[model samples]
Target chain A: MKLLEIKNLHASVAGKQILKGINLTINAGEVHAIMGPNGAGKSTLSAVITGHPMYEVSEGEILLNGKDLLSMNPEERAREGVFLSFQYPAEIPGVSMVNFMRTALNEKRKYHNLPQLSATEFLRLMREKKAMLAMGDKFANRAVNEGFSGGEKKKNEIFQMAMLQPVLQILDETDSGLDIDALRIVADGVNKLKSQDNASIVITHYQRLLDYIVPDFVHVLADGKIVETGTKDLALYLEEKGYVAYN
Target chain B: MCEEIVLKANESRDIVIVNEPNVRLRISQEEGSQLRLHIIDWQSADNDVHIEQVASNCVTEIYQVAYLKDNQKVTTHTNVRHLVGGGVSKQVLRFVLSEHAKGDFLGTLYIAKDAQKSCAEQSNRNLLLDDTATMRTRPQLEIYADDVQATHGATTGQLDENALFYMQQRGISRQAAERMLIVAFLSEAIETIRNEEQKEKLLNTIDSIL
Candidate 1:
């Protein structure tokens, strides 16, 4: 079933148009890779989908599981099972990761009319997720993303995605700034978290991450629009020929 | 009214001031006496605080925090005099101002000529949430003695905009994010309170206001 459908979506930041007219549909149990060069509006698409306040959607509609996503606020959209794993996770000093995750999970649970998890239950779940990501015990007590290494930040995002278990996950440049080992660990975490009931959108510049995640579909975003869409072979073709030929 | 209290050796005291104007408190600690004071500067028409350590080997700690808004002006003066040797004193003060509110702090730490081997530190931090708000912080340190460690620092600034945007991106509303940042800013002073009930009550009060 289609989990998200974006049609003729045009977005602008600071009154300057960035995403001209974009159309895409994502279904469950599928991984979609969006590849583009710098200034191709790859990040803008993610920001607009996540309802970042700086971006203004000038036209078109976005439907998440047949609901109007444009009508919901950022938090409401998140509670509705739309998660964006930011390229640069925020560093919140003095706010422990434990506290932040607990609050986020509880808030999402409350939106679904579920009872709050007890402290023991929450901690157990956190430990399990961290173990899956191969993170250390110290991550739970440290400030949220504060003083964390580059790889740790990306892994923490995936870990949060695991805990939240959103229906549609948007991985914005998750492979950037990651070494070979860190890339494998992050890809492994994402692979483990995948299931037939959910899907993901992997935004990246290189085909290396696509080799691991193996997107079922590849879309080339250029000049604020998706200009090409094809199977995994398209990613290899672009990697060999580069984006200039496509433009 | 004037109150003069002496803390005997190895004694500890917890003082709570809710409402008062023009308060002059003279507190002297004997040798080995430890004084932990939490001065809640809330709704004081006018407030003044004076403390001194007259004996050696004594420890003094003072924590003062105030939240003011709506054209209210609060002035807090703290004077710590270390007359003897081998004593330590620490003072931490913070104020959150909003609307047209005004806050002023006068902190004075004096180490006498013969007060050797003494350590004194004072820090005053203020947060101004509104453009019209004003804060004046004066940290005065008079150290006449050699071989003594003394330090004082004061800073006043507005909320961090980047932090606010970061929280907003995480699906937290702007208002909730602001409240969390303000609470975190004030928690520095609130964490020093030894009484659990008092700390919780003050926290709840601050939350309600926000």
Candidate 2:
């Protein structure tokens, strides 16, 4: 039943230690919120799990359904159903959102030994997913995140999540830079995609997002490790009293 | 000096050159004439293009893209002369080089006396896929006429590392990501072609080479 397991993970970036040792396990149909201060290595944890080339994993083990994940490349990790919604999504000029998404979806399908979608089927699926994120058809012709507003970029990230349908979705500070309205719509879209067969990892600093996408488990990460893990009330407790308690 | 050609009033011309052994063109435009020129070089030694607007209210546009690898070297020179007022000229050029390939671009724009209110702009962008690839660019502007608008810029760089990682996180290999970024870089000029079939063919050729 366990979807992802991080055991004694230690990682470093640019020769500086970030993640000392992180151990966490997630089952199917569960939402885990990782709350930490600015330098607590929350993003580093996500990057290491996703096999970012910048990070040097000095020690530890990562497993997706008991398969060794650290041995796989970044693209291989993605094909294994791991997704990271980047906090600062890159802007690719002259590459349309439609072409990018189709290539990604088809690559995933090819990895799973499935046939590629026909043009009609691909467009139909794109329309269905775009409607979920309230994205307009104009985005299909425009470049990927080239001229999009902050809110639109965040929405586009979620739109991509819908198109890829990864089993283990990691939302890395998705609520940052989002207005209240954008936050609601993004959280709503994420909520609609939750199923019993998939899990999520929500990384954020504020508890405002937890009120919308309530997490089943909350973990306090400080000094490169999880200091505490508790139920939903822990989020409220941390909201009332900030991570200063853990500090 | 290449043989000179002229376009009469109210005329339009579209010229395309691809991997020619030698390219030397000089065109003179009469009143109310239009010229659209494209120069795509996969491998070449030298290319020279000059467009002169002799009368008023003429238009000129030039687009170029060059892809080179190994020890190939290419030099391109463009000269646009505005003799009368009420004319417009624009140029966009791109170069992609890998390995030990070298590229050079010299763009010259001149607005003669009494050629007031003429507008001209030039942009040159190059992509170096390897450390040894070299690009030399010189954009010269000589505007004797007062009350004219002209601008020119040039830049050389590598691919975006952040964008590459973003794509790899979405299941695209690094090779594929590089291809996408390179196509995105050069496609800006390719998009301006008026013919759809030619545009598609050139796009496919670029993609296949990449």
Candidate 3:
């Protein structure tokens, strides 16, 4: 079934158009890779989908599981099973990672008419996810993303993704600031979280990440539109031939 | 003027005051006494406070918070003197100013010549929420005894705009974000209250005011 359908979407930031008439459809149990050069509006697409206040959707519609996605607020969209791992995940000082994740997970669960997890249950789940990501126990007590290394921050984001288990996960440049080792850990975490019930959108500039978290379909986003679409071979093609020719 | 009061060893005292203009208070602690004082002045006023630890094994905690709006002006002066040994004193003060409000804090810590092995700490933090708002803070320490421990720190800044936006983007309204920031900023001082009921009541009162 189609999970998300974006039809001729146009978005602008500060009254300047960035995404101009873009269309894409994503289904369950699939990984879609969005590759583009700088200023190609790859981040803009994610921001608009997440209902960022700075971006204004001028035209078209976004449907998540057959519901209007653009009309909901950011948290409501998140509760509706849309997750965006920000390019620069916010650093929240004085708010511990464990508390933040627990609150977020409980909020999502509450929205879905589920019972809130007890403290012991929550801690156990957190420990399981942390061990999966090879994160230490110290991270659970520290402030959310404060004083964390770049790789740790990215790993924390994936850990949060694992805990929330959203239906549609948007990885916005998750591989940007990670080393080879960190990149492998992050990809492994993402791979472990994948299932037949949900899907993912991997937004990146290089194809190295696509090699690990192989995309079922590769879409080249240029000037705010998906100009080319193909299988995994398209990612190889873009890697061999830079975006200069695509524009 | 200085007033000497006896707490009768092992007794706890809670003092709450709203300092009026040009108000001055001097308090001296006795042996084995415990004192929790809250000084809150939200009006346009100038105030001075002096606290002295004259006896051993005494516990002193002072909390001062000010919230000013409009074109209000406030200046606070504090002096903490540890004259004896084996005592502990903690002072925490915070100021939140908006509009064209102005604030000034002068805090002094003195470890006397014979006050040995005493632990004293003073912290002052100010938040400026508007461009026109201003704050000036000075923290002075005079430690004449080598065996005593004294620490003082002061900071003046604005709220974290990014954190505010992050909260706002999550469906929390701007007012809610401001409330959260204010509570977070003041929680450190509030947590020092040994009485849970009073702390919760004061927190709820502040929330209602906001």
lDDT winner = 2
User: Which candidate leads the pack in TM-score?
Assistant: 2
Docking class of 3: acceptable
TM-scores of chain A, one for each prediction? 0.98, 0.98, 0.99
Mark the regions of model 3 whose C-alpha exceeds 4 Å error after superposition: B1-23, B27-47, B51-62, B66-75, B80-91, B96-124, B127-161, B164-179, B194-210
Among these predictions, the greatest DockQ belongs to 2
What are the per-residue Cα lDDT tens digits for candidate 2 across A36-143? 888999999999989888999999999998899999999889988899999999999988888898888888899999999998999999899899988888998889
Better of 2 and 3 by DockQ: 2
lDDT of 1 by residue, A172-208 (tens): 9999999999999999999998998899999999999
Tens digit of per-residue lDDT, candidate 2, span B83-187: 999999999999999999999999999999899999999999999999999999999999999899999999999999889889989998889989999999989
Off by over 4 Å in 1: A237-247, B19-22, B30-32, B42-45, B55-57, B82-87, B111-120, B141-174
Query: In candidate 2, residue B31 scores what lDDT?
Result: 99
Q: Which RMSD values do the candidates have, in order? A: 3.1, 1.3, 4.9
lDDT of 3 by residue, B1-210 (tens): 234455666677887665466657777778878888777767787868787888888888888888888988888888888888888988899999998998988888888888899999899999998899999988889888899878888888888766655553443445655676777687677667667887788778776766
Question: Candidate 2: where is the Cα deviation over 4 Å?
Answer: B1-3
lDDT of 1: 0.86
